[model samples]
Target: PVRPLWAAAATAPPAGAEWVWKATNDVLNDLYAVLRFEVQRGPLSRSPSAVSHANQVYPKLMPFLRWWKQQPDRPPLYYATLDVKGAFDSIPHQKLLEVIRPLLREEDGYLKCPYSRWCGKTGKARTVYGVVTKERFGDVEAVRERGRRLGHGRGSFAVFMDLVEYRLLSRTQLLALLTRHICSHV
Candidate 1:
């Protein structure tokens, strides 16, 4: 059983008619604890926060630097890192839940999603919000690198890099650079 904790518009109509669903410890302490545990069992082995590519790439850098050293006149290089502040929030909740649905099929638990019980400031409001369950670490997802299990995933960062590199740098230009820097050195 959940309750609606709402606040009316501070300034004008629809300015901030916010509705917050409150899941008191009394209502969900035991059930959600179990819910969280059941969903997490034997799944999502990939760690989202690990810097795995650094391991593969750092070792290869030795070869690249050695190759670069052999070159007559090397141009300046540019490689920047992107740190998205709300990278976790950018992903849609429903989209991620859809991915997790299949994993839950084998789960033997039967718990109905709790919804808001009270009406909002609006007359007889009935905007029912669901339980809103998620992983203990809400942001962690399979899209992240399987750092614990290196070979498990191709890595989200790697896939994103591939897409960006494909669009920004032409194959011929990359191949020519690699060839001039690597093959000739070999």
Candidate 2:
């Protein structure tokens, strides 16, 4: 079951307002980790200029800004800041799923253990354990090589659970809901 936990916002709102945080169960969190990994490795990979981590924002931009300002013929420089802290709340879940579904299905891929033990046959399994070492320490490179051997390792399914106030939905029912519409138009 998903739990809702509320924490104080950084700054209080002018009027009546509250913040609610949705915390997922362990199983859902694990599922999310896998989804996030695949989404990052495959579709929706971040651009080099993107500053996703708070600690990275200054490090990434400061040097560039310094060099640009040093340029004698530099044109007028401008920057913009957007407060997207609450942006997700404005996005509809169904629409969010709709946007994600195509990205997940873009490559029509599946999930397999990175070790390849579960999905691979004898003499067929791909293992990075022996291949990658502390000297190399290049798991990302190894994963890319694995992708060349395998196909694009993108996700084939997207799961969404919208929890109402006091309702609890079992994992089985959710799985059923996920596959329910597959054959309707087939």
The parts of candidate 2 lying over 4 Å away from their true place are 1-27, 42-46, 61-88, 106-109, 112-186
How does model 1 fare in lDDT? 0.33
Candidate 1 residue spans exceeding 4 A from truth:
1-52, 85-186
- For each candidate in the order shown, give its overall lDDT on alpha carbons: 0.33, 0.39
Model 1 worst lDDT window (10 residues)? 157-166
Q: What's the TM-score of every candidate structure? A: 0.20, 0.34
| Count of clashing residue pairs in every prediction | 0, 0
Per-residue C-alpha lDDT of model 1 across residues 1-186, encoded as one tens digit per residue: 322323343455455555544432223233333334334453432423222245755664566667777899999854532211111244444443343344333232332222222323333423221212233123323312221222223321121111121112222332334334322222
Overall local distance difference test of candidate 2: 0.39
- The alpha-carbon lDDT assigned to residue 89 of candidate 1 equals 40
RMSD of 1: 22.5
